[model samples]
Target: MASLTIRQLDKSYPLAKGARNLVLNKIDLTLHSNEFVSIVGASGCGKSTLLSIAAGLEEFDSGEVLVDDQPIQGPGIDRGVVFQSYTLLPWLTARQNIEFALKSAGYAHTERAEIAQQHLELVKLAHAADKWPAELSGGMQQRVAIARALSYRPKILLMDEPFGALDAMTRRQMQQLLLEIWETHRLTVMFVTHDIEEAIYLSDRVVVMKPAEIDQCIDIPIERPRDFSVTHHPDFLNIQSQIFERISQPLEHA
Candidate 1:
């Protein structure tokens, strides 16, 4: 079943003096259950805007977005979002951050602690459960963010470059961790990123977007249980080259 469906999605922002700036134009996309889909494009291409719309955090100018066939009107527990920034409360520890989400989700008090610790352990940060956001490393902070998002057990996970702020090494580690988590939980994920390799590495299919619409949708033929070593395979290099060439094209508005 399709977990999320977006059709004819057009989004614009009001400009000064009664003008409008179009950001997403007539876009159509669908994410199947347990699928990992990544949207990639240059800056100002509206990839993040698309993600925000999917998360119901932003409204679109026209069109319909559905989760499990029901139209999305606003933020709902059916979806969980993780942005590039580690949006944890500074006063809350790692576990507390997740517990807070659970509490807000109406989970029972006793169950909240158990679910929070389980998710922390899922992200391999159970040992750092008591650490504040400032006390954790960049990658660790993102892990906490992921754990918090998953604590609600949303049907779909929306990530907008959740690893963009980490160092190269840490980013790779997070990628592996994410893959493991996704496999374990069978999540339906829609991730947005500017990094082509990261998109290719983590996605089952890569959706390349231009300024306001999709340019291409390419499937990664690589087998699952993937690791960093797959990057050197011939098929991986070929697919990467094709996506790189597509993204290198000059934008119409540019």
Candidate 2:
């Protein structure tokens, strides 16, 4: 099983000359195996930075990040990342896009094509497997991106506001599709989103962040196979209220 562990992680960005702006400060978080966790916070609070660090895309000044007891030195095949933008190569067909990743995962040339097609169908995009990125709609493109990320069988899926650009209905549809894939494969997922209801509905726990640290890690407690209907559940509303309250308040420095 894949599990992510972070302890006392710190990140900062340098400015002009000698000044630096601290973003994530002394952060500690752990995502257990087969767990779904979503992070929510205001902009510029280093939410994305933290995820980038976990993906081994960014450097940390202090602390450690380990996946299944192994330290992450840089980006590895064990982790797959999906960004806010589609990040697909415009010229490549959906199947080709997935094939590109499978190539890096070291699959044989013949094996790559078959694996790519399988993942396309997994994301329900087999019919559009031959379509170019420019030819597909936003939602469909994101589906292709998801298919590509999963094609190599990464142990963890790191998503950074992947559906933030989609329309409401399409976003919901994608969410359901994601849940279906998750249930079937049970890959450890760490999703970052700005939507409170979406976080509550999709995550096993909701991580509330302040500027440089987490304020709370609220457990969702809501039963799985959850649909949009969970949004109206009494406990769901209560959890939403809790998250809203945490975010609305000003950060308290330690």
Q: What residue runs in model 2 are displaced by over 4 Å at the alpha carbon?
A: 251-254
**Pairing residues by index, what is the TM-score of model 2?**
0.97
Query: What's the distance in Å from true for residue 182, model 1?
Result: 0.6
**Compared with the true structure, what per-residue lDDT tens digits does model 2 show for residues 1-254?**
59999999989889999998989888989999999999999887889999999999999899999999899989998999999899999888999999999887899999999998899899888999899999999999999999989888899999999999999999999999999999999989899999999888889999999898888999999888988888999999999998998898866641
lDDT score, candidate 2? 0.92
- Which candidate number would show the highest lDDT if scored against the true structure? 1
Q: Model 1, range 1-254, lDDT digits (tens) per residue?
A: 23899999999999999999999999999999999999988888999999999999998889999998899989877898999999999999999999999999899998999999999999999999999999999999999999999998999999999999999999999999999999889989999998888999999999998888899999999999999999999999998998888788888543
TM-score of 1: 0.97
Among all windows of ten consecutive residues in candidate 2, which has the lowest summed lDDT?
Answer: 245-254
lDDT for every model? Answer: 0.92, 0.92
